[model samples]
Target: MPAPTEITVHQQSRVLEIAFDDGTRFRIPFELMRIYSPSAEVKGHGPGQEVLQTGKRDVLITALEPIGHYAVRPEFSDGHASGLFSWDYLHKLGSQQDALWRDYEARLAAAGKGRDDAMPGKAGGSCHSH
Candidate 1:
């Protein structure tokens, strides 16, 4: 896998721009990242137990921290910071964004949900304390 040469978080555009050593670059949207987060909170522990994320259309990356030389941890405005996105995973996300979006839409439709709908029974609170 090609290593990332540059990574920039565009707050205004809500996208993470990454450039790889192989001259490949991608601008992945924040919404996509949050919905597709590879965390147990979102992905669940077992197959067919995935939690669908909603009301994340305007999710923001509050902070981005690197983990050694392999991955990055992002703190989102919604208090989600468990997912560590590796270079390979980010590259795959960038490359397959369109298909991912289609799958997301299909899941939402099958569940009779909308992108902006809030998750039911979710109590409003911070996942972390300051």
Candidate 2:
């Protein structure tokens, strides 16, 4: 597989632009990345156990940390920082963004949910604090 030669996170556009060694490049949206996160919190441990992510339309990436030359860990502004996006997975997401986004919208509609529903009312207090 072609490894990523460069990755650019556009905060204004909320997309990550990746360029691979094979001359293939793609721009992936933040919403898509967050919803399809590979972490156990999102993907679950087994097949068919995926948790649908919602209300992440405006999630911002606060930072990016390289992981052992294979993946990048994105720290989201909403406090979610668990998913490690590998090269292969990022490529898949970039290549299939349209279909996946459509499916996500459909799922949200089916579940009577919207982007605003994924988080609590903006009073801004996290239960994760110790």
Candidate 3:
């Protein structure tokens, strides 16, 4: 994976704009990035231990702090800021955005929940109870 040459985040749109030296630019949504975060709270310790993040469709990133030269720490509006997004991971997300997003949507559908279902007062959607 190529390293990102620039990363500009749009707080209002809740999107992260990444530019690679190879001329690739991707606008990744905040919800997508939050769900796919590499943090232990989300990724867990191993396979099958991964936690399905709910109530994040409306989660917006409030801050992004640079971590050294290879990663950025994304602070979300939901109070999750532990995920240190590495360059390789960001690149992978950009490359596999379509498949990942599709899979997420499918999972939500299979669980009988929509993305907005987790947001409490928004559209009067409620969290899915398993």
Pick the lDDT winner. Answer: 1
Model 3 deviation from native, Cα RMSD in Å: 5.5
Query: After superposing candidate 2, which stretches have Cα over 4 Å from the reference?
Result: 120-130
Per-prediction TM-score to the true structure, in the order listed: 0.92, 0.86, 0.83
The best-first sequence of candidates by lDDT reads 1, 2, 3
Alpha carbon lDDT of each predicted model: 0.93, 0.86, 0.83
RMSD of each: 4.7, 4.6, 5.5
| Cand. 3 Cα-lDDT | 0.83
The per-candidate count of clashes, in order, stands at: 0, 1, 0
lDDT tens readout by residue for model 1, 1-130: 9899999999999999999999999999999999999998888767777889889999999999999999999999989999999999999999999999999999999999999999777658424232
Total residue pair clashes for candidate 1: 0
Order the candidates by TM-score, highest first — what do you get?
1, 2, 3
**Model 2 poorest 10 in a row by lDDT:** 121-130
| Winning candidate number (TM-score) | 1
Which candidate do you rate higher for TM-score, 1 or 3? 1
